[model samples]
Target: MTPDHPKSRRSFSDFLLHLHPRTIPEENLRLTLSWGLGGMAVMLVCLLFLTGILLLLTYQPSTGSAYASIVTLTREVRFGLWIRNIHHWSANLLVVIAMLHLLRIVLTGAFGQGRRLNWIIGLFLLFLLLSANFTGYLLPWDQLAYWAVTICTSMLGYIPVGGLWLQELFRGGAEIGPATLSNFCVLHVAFIPATLFVLLLWHFWLVRRAGGLVQVEHDNPDDVPVQRVPTVPNLIVREAAVGLVLVAFILILAIVWDAPLMEQANPGMSPNPAKAPWYFLGFQELLLHLHPVFASFLWPLLGVAALLWVPFWQDSALPTGVWFGSNSGRRLVIWTATVGALTTLAIILADNLLLQSNAAVAVDTLVTRGLLPTALLIALLVGFYFLLVKGLKYTRAEAVMAGIVLVLVALAVCTIIGVWFRGAEMHLVWL
Candidate 1:
């Protein structure tokens, strides 16, 4: 037998304390909080990976074989159906958790101070996560996936100069074909994951270095106290618990129902009441009410520009972590509301535009319309910006009023885009 060493007798607790240089407190709330979400994110990623690997064994990426392979996985392979369900749900869950995490940071004002870079990276991660889901959605080669991509890629047409070329790059052709499927598959499987993994590492590293936001800090420096606990165990525990609960729920769902597989995708057949994915449904609903050019292109572009320019709009008025003393809090709330409203309006426009027009019901002719609506949209954006950024006085009430107006404007724009796309009569199924 090997001789007993003095260090070995000290136990795991002794080793942990030595490494951390901080005591593991009897009650470490910080650790508990951090671990909860972190663990959930990890578990969800693992679940997605495992399911995706299993799916790859059965999935065929070719245009001809793609739908058939999915059908086979659902009908023939044992537990294959369950695995797919888990995969689908996990993708959605990942998006949801990431959004919640972003919200948590914002609501707590944790993104102020030293964590701004992390906030930007977190936002980019959210965008990439959404992109991953979108790519994966198209792989099934179903009606819903088909139309969703059609409308989504169609929006790329709004880009200046090289918009058409960029759209072509996405489609790999004029329509959905082998190239589109293969490219999206590669992105969903490899590109997205690689980017996410790198950014996530940077994100966590920032979190570890800066410390998980001053979760319960007082605005007044006199009232603020130094945090004592190192976040590790308790945080992990909470994250694990949330993840376990989610996994249990997902497993039960998988056991009860198989993944949904629609028709074999006959390109010629038109489903009269075709729909986009539920999330995009709000946008599709926009098409029923708004003018295609204005609603679809100009309005949406302005909305994105507005989001990117928010920090700049505030200028140099407030310093980092300075939430109070000025009207910043109210202004921030207004800003968030404006963005949310803009998103909602975009949806409404999609739903209601072309409801009364002769060409409205058709799904193939959206692009043929003239430049008037588009020009009007551009003009409206310029007018709105002038009013919101220049004309409106910088006050709490002004901010509140601006937010309300933004919501209405955005909803209208999205509704218009939806109507324009749906009315084209192309038999698109974005669901």
Candidate 2:
């Protein structure tokens, strides 16, 4: 017997239809606008989710068996290696695509004014993605995964108060062990994915609600708006095409690189230069130059807070929806960003050179680590604000774009240095 009749029952097809609008403006279909980064990222998410589910069938999260299970999955099970590699690569790629997607939003002024809440949601997603990645990194039960996670969790112990407790709460003990693995395994496979699904739904809905991408005429910024096309075939087909290319790229990497799985974790034998995961190497590298508090937490926290506050603090009413607003806006962003990059690099260089020899121990550490570097950053941003306001006469939205570019450049430089330039003992080795 069939179930009781329902009013307008929600079928699978109906749910698919409800996902996006039947039609979107033709202008919203511009590939050059958003670069399909968000769509590709979403596809990566789905790919990883499926592969991860398959892996879960045979993988054991227990400490004693975790390493053995992963080994069995990679070497014993049929096509298990391919599935694991794809899942691993897709997880890494998702973070990169998400960062690129965020950059697109910043450059295009997509998070301006009325979109403040979406910006916050995006930040939360970023945090969750990073958290998920961190938790997943430990699942392999290998040397790289073990040491990297140990270092990452230990960083939290440096927090002023209740920090150690928080660290232990996640660690499941005073140290990284079986309980810690169990906690992360649950968080990685369960909590993060569930939270991500909810946020993704909200993100997509907001995109549709916000009327899709902002229409911008390159030759004429002030020109009237363009028409939108249906999201079904036009937008959907294009996204699928881009997604196919992305999948091919990931598959090729999985074939060529096969996810690195070192010997099972040896807490006794620490790898030399035991680096954090590549995504976090930037923060670890900064620890070489700055105080732990600043490098590990405060500095990055400040950057995130600034991004969260930008939409709220900057002029919300200012005309947005265009990439860099006006032509003048583009020039302003370029010049300010260039200055900010150079300024940060110069400060870093000076601290390494001049401040290293300073006999005033307390003063040298403070200057090189925290106070002076921060003061310079503040001054640079202030200078940028004046230049945007007085020199270029920029609207608030335009200035915020420039500011974001500067921050992105600084962070990128640090990441590049950390990942490629640092040598044994975290020394700056020219690569």
Candidate 3:
């Protein structure tokens, strides 16, 4: 109202410019530094740096001598066991902790409003994490590592047009051989790491520009004002705490239990029941139960398409002032979850029963060679989609549905682990 006031004029300009002022609360910022993802990310990056340095000293990424070099490192090099342990554990921890950090962001609802791009970056980070882990898995040169890569590459056959080519690229040949191992090792230790480093730097730069986590929705200034702390000091403390704990634990595990090394890979011998890594075994399971069109192509395609459409599920055809939950939006989420869980349970039970039945017992000549298992896998994935779409009409809570679906998926995973453990005990190699 004061037309001539300097402060009033500046305030008007600020409003017109769409600017908002925020005072940095030192205590709040300091606390953010203490526990936020910034600390976690720094710890993971540090682990990568230290362990990667150690790995570079001994790792020989070549087709002819890579496995032999690893053997030499374990048997001959000084403290080489520790170095390998650090590299293995650091890679595993990086992925696990990064997921945790992403979950923290999601639970805190920090992905809403202007932070959508941050969420996208986090998703890309997850993809990179998986790529990094997958590449690393191929480096150990054990049976588990070798055939696991083979099984995974084979899954690309489900891709529509270029699946075969993609699979070849992964193998670096028409089949899994020394070239595949060497190529993967290079990507793991060299190329992927370089890209990861660049992306990580970009991610942090974005974080800095965006500022840290938004205040929790439940926080009330009248109740207790939040605190803000500077990034440097708090990072030094909290990251040291988490990083040291993780590193020490891995060191102890490595010292006590050497990583499993199955017999040197032999492409000529197909073991009784070869399996991929656990993360991919579920997918491998899918290949058992359906036709290629249903198993490899349509199912994965649809699953991903469903995930992409999630944000739009409750929205109308055109943007409107109506709220997302004005109708049965939340109810729909619950029904989706309920249906997914039920279908997964059915498919898993069916698979286990079939595997243990007389049909599996007989193990006819051709079927035993691996076609039966592959067909069973295709069936499983198709069955999963069939059951998932069954409960679209229910009314329930989103959280409840998500929890139920999670439980079902976990149960199926546990079942697979049980099967693997039994096979492992029998010394029956399957991969």
Q: Would you list the clashing residue pairs of candidate 2?
A: 23-230, 24-228, 24-229, 25-228, 25-229, 26-227, 26-228, 26-229
TM-score of every prediction relative to native? 0.70, 0.90, 0.69
**How close to the true structure is residue 211 of candidate 2, measured as C-alpha lDDT?**
70
Off by over 4 Å in 3: 1-38, 218-226, 292-298, 302-346, 354-431
For candidate 2, write residues 1-431 as lDDT tens digits: 23433434435325655777777778778788889998898999999889989999989998899999999998899989989999999999998999999988887777765577788998999899999999999998999999999999988987768889999999999989999999999999999999999998898888767777655535674575556566656877898899999999988888888888999999998887888888888787677677777777778888888887777774632354566676787787778668767876776676556545864544326565677777867897888877877886777677677777888877777777778876776656786
Candidate closer to the true structure by TM-score (higher is better), 1 or 2: 2
Instruction: After the best TM-score superposition of candidate 3, give how far the Cα of residue 278 lies from its true spot, in angstroms.
Output: 2.5
Candidate 3 overall Cα lDDT vs. reference?
0.58
lDDT values of the candidates? Answer: 0.62, 0.81, 0.58
The regions of model 2 sitting more than 4 angstroms off are 1-14, 217-226, 314-318, 336-339, 354-368
TM-score result, candidate 1: 0.70
Q: Which model is ahead, 1 or 3, in terms of TM-score?
A: 1
- Writing each residue's lDDT as its tens digit, candidate 1 over 324-404 gives 214754565567566756656554445334433455354333443325444655576556546655676454323423443
